[model samples]
Target: MTSRAPAFPLISATGEAMRRLGRWCCVCAALLAAGCATYGPERPGEKIYRDVVFAAPGGHKLRMDIYVPRQSKPAPVVLWFFGGGWSFGSKGYHVNVRDLTTAGIAVASVQYRMSHTAVYPAQLEDCRAAAQWLRDNGARYGIDSTRMGASGESSGGQLAAMLAAAEGKSRIRAVCALYAPTDMVELAQLYSKPGRLSLVDKFLGGPADQKLDVAVNASPLNYISRALPPFLIIHGEFDGVVPLEQSERLFLALTDVGVETQFIVVPGKRHWFRLDNTQFAEVSRFFQVNLKR
Candidate 1:
C-alpha cells in the first residue's frame, strides 16, 4: 500500500469550504427575502376610476381609466396607450399604473378605435379628443392639465409620439414611446420586402406608395419640429417587430431640428421585453422630472 500524505487535511479543507458556501447561501437567501418584503403590497390610497367616457367620435364612445394618486396637491397626468399592432388592444391593461400613482402621478389609460374599426387619423383623433377631455375636465379629478404627458408601447407609442409632435393647444408637454414605429413609409417599405403589407398599410388603408400623403401625414417623424416637446424614446436592440433603426431615425430627426430628446437602446432584449422594476423606476423618474414641472 503506497502511503499517501494524510487525506484528512484535504477533506477538512473541502468541508470548511462547503460550510462557508452554505453560510453565504443563507445570507443571500435572507437578502432576497428582505428585498421581497419591501415590495409588500399596493399603496392604500391609489384610486382608479373605470370606464369614464372621454369622447364619442362617430358615435363610438371612447372611454379611459383614470388612476388618481392620494396627494395633497393635484398630480400631473400621463395618458397611457396599450400596444396591439393598431388593430387590437384595450385600456384595461397598463404597465406601472400603481407605481406611477404611488409616485404622485395620475395615469389615464385611453381607449382608441383599432384599425379594424377605423383607420389612420381616426385613432389619432380619438387620442387627441382624450387629451382634450383630460385638459378640460382635469380639475374634477385633481389632475394638472398643463403638466400632462403621454406614454405608450408599440402602436400606442406611435400615438403618444404623434400626440407630442402635433402642433396644437392640446399637445402633450412630454412624450415617452417604447418600441414605437416612427415612419409609416419606412415601415411599409420594410414589410413590403416579404411580399405582404404591414400594419402600417392596414392602418393607413393602403400601401405607402398608394397612400403617400396619408402615410406622411400619419408619421410622427414628419411632424418633428423645434416646437415639439421633450421626448424619451426607448427601444430594444433586438426588436424584430419594430426595428431599432426606427427609433434611431426618430431621434436623429428630433436632434436635427433642435428638439430635446433621449434615446435608450436596451441590449439583448427583443420587441416585447417586459420592463423590470428598475426600468419602471427610471420611467417614473422621467415623468417626475418632466410632468411634475
Candidate 2:
C-alpha cells in the first residue's frame, strides 16, 4: 500500500500503449489492403456495356463487352479476346479489364465463333470485324479509335496477334499476346502427339498436312512485316499447350522485319498463369507508350 498512489498512473500508461498498438495495427492493415487492392481484380466505378453486337456472321450475333474508364475525354481502346484453343471461351472471362480501365484505357472483351461453330479464318474474321466495329463506332463510346490496341490470352492471343498482323482498314497501334499460338502450322506439328492432334486439327478443320495453306493463312508468323504494329509477346516457358517456340518465332520474325517487338518468357509457368501487378503494369505501359503518342 506504500506505492499504491502510482498504480492508477501505471494502469493509465498501459492502457494508452495498448490503444496506440491497436491504432498502429489498423494503419498497417489498411496499407496492406490498399496494396493488395492494386493487384486485385476489383472493378469499381467501371461503366460496362455488355452484349453489344459487333457483327452478325452466318446469322450468329458476335458480341463484345466494352469497359469504359472514367476519363475527361475519350480514352484509348484495347480489344481483348478470350483463350479457348478456338473451341471454348467467352468475353466474360477477362483478367485486366479493371486495371486497364483504371489507367485511362477502355477495354473491349470480344467474342468470336469457336471451332465447333466455325473454322480458322472464321474466328480471325470475327476478331477483325470486332476491331473494325470499334473503329467505326468508337466515337459513341468515347474511345480513341486511332489509338487502338489488341490483346488476348491463349487462343484469344492467337486472334489478337492476327488482328495486329493481318491486313485491315483500321490500324491496331499495339499488340500483346499471352501464351498464344503464333504459328498454327508449327503448333499443329508440335502438338501432334497422340490425343493432342485434335486440338489444332479441330480449329483448322483438318490436319496441318491436309490443310497446310489454311494453317499458314491462320498463323500470325506468316503475316509479320515492317508495317506491323509494335508487339509484346509473352509466353510461359513450360507451356505444354502452345509451345514457347511459337512466341520466339514470332519475336524473331518481328525483329527481322524491323517491327518493334518484345518477348517475355515467364519461367516455370504453364499454358495459363495468374497475371501479377507487374505484368499488368507492363501492359499498361506498353499501350501508353505506343498508343498515348
Candidate 3:
C-alpha cells in the first residue's frame, strides 16, 4: 500500500476553523452577558427588583422594575409607564420613582407592548397585568395593594387613564396623566397633515377615520365614567405634539360625568416636563393624598 503523506494542511485548516469558532463563541457570550446587565441607577434607601416578569402575553415576557420604600409598614404603589408615543420607550428611562418612593410610596415602572408589537388593548393589557401583579404580590415587596395608583406621561399618560378606567378587578384608586392624548379621533384630525406617520395611526394600526371603532375604543375619553378614580391631567400650553384640547376634552368629559378631575396648563412648556418641576410635585402629592394610608 502506498504511504499517504500526513494531512498537515487539513490539520491546519481544522485548527483555524476551531479558533474562529472559539472567537465567535466569545463574542456571543459577551453579548448575552451585556443583555443580562442591570440598567439605570437605583435610588438610595429603597430596594429595587429589576426585570421581574409580571406577565407572559403571547409567550412574550413583560417585565417591571419594582422600587419599594424603606418604610416598615406596607407602602402604596404607583404603576408608572414611560412614553414614546407607544412606539418606543423603556421602563428605566423618564421614571419618577425617586420622587414617589421618597414620599414613602412604592413604584412599579412597568413595560407594556408597544405599537410595533401589538395595538390598542395589547398595551393596555400589559399595563393591567402589571397592576394586577402588583395588586396580588405587592405586599411581599412592602406595597399596600389597596392603595394602588397609575400615572404616566405622554402616551403612557393615556394608558394610565385607560387602566384606571378599566379597573376590572384591580381598582386603581387614582391617576395622573401628563400631556396625554385623551381623544384619539380628534388627535387623528389634528395630525392629518400629509407625509407623516401619525402616532395615533401607529397606535391604532391605521388612520383613526378608517379605524373609527378602534380609535374610539382606544380613547380614554370613551371609557370615562363616575366609577373612575380621581384624575389629574396636566398639559403643556405649547405641546405641539398632543394638542392642549386633548387634555381639555378628557377633563371636560370627566367633569360632565361628575368625576373629580383637574386640568393644569403649564405655560411655554412642551410635551416633556421636568421631574423637578412644580407640576411633578403635584403628581407626588396626588398619589400621596389618594394612595397614602
Top candidate by lDDT: 3
Q: Please provide, for model 1 over 89-132, each residue's C-alpha lDDT reduced to its tens digit, 9 standing for 90 to 100.
A: 56765343446898899989889998878898999889888988
lDDT score, candidate 3: 0.76
Candidate 3, residue 109: the lDDT equals 88
Give Cα-based local distance difference scores for all models: 0.74, 0.74, 0.76
lDDT of 2 by residue, 169-276 (tens): 148888889888887776666545444345578889877788899998988888878878888888876665566767777787888877778877776776666577
Query: TM-scores across all candidates?
Result: 0.81, 0.82, 0.83
Give the residue spans of candidate 3 off by over 4 A. 1-39, 168-170, 193-197
How many clashes would you count in candidate 1?
A: 0
Q: Flag the better candidate by lDDT, 1 or 3.
A: 3
TM-score, model 3 to reference: 0.83
Measured with C-alpha atoms, the lDDT of residue 201 in candidate 1 is 74
TM-score (C-alpha) between model 2 and the true structure: 0.82
Candidate 2: misplaced stretches above 4 Å? 1-42, 168-170, 193-197
Error of 1 at 229 (Å): 0.9
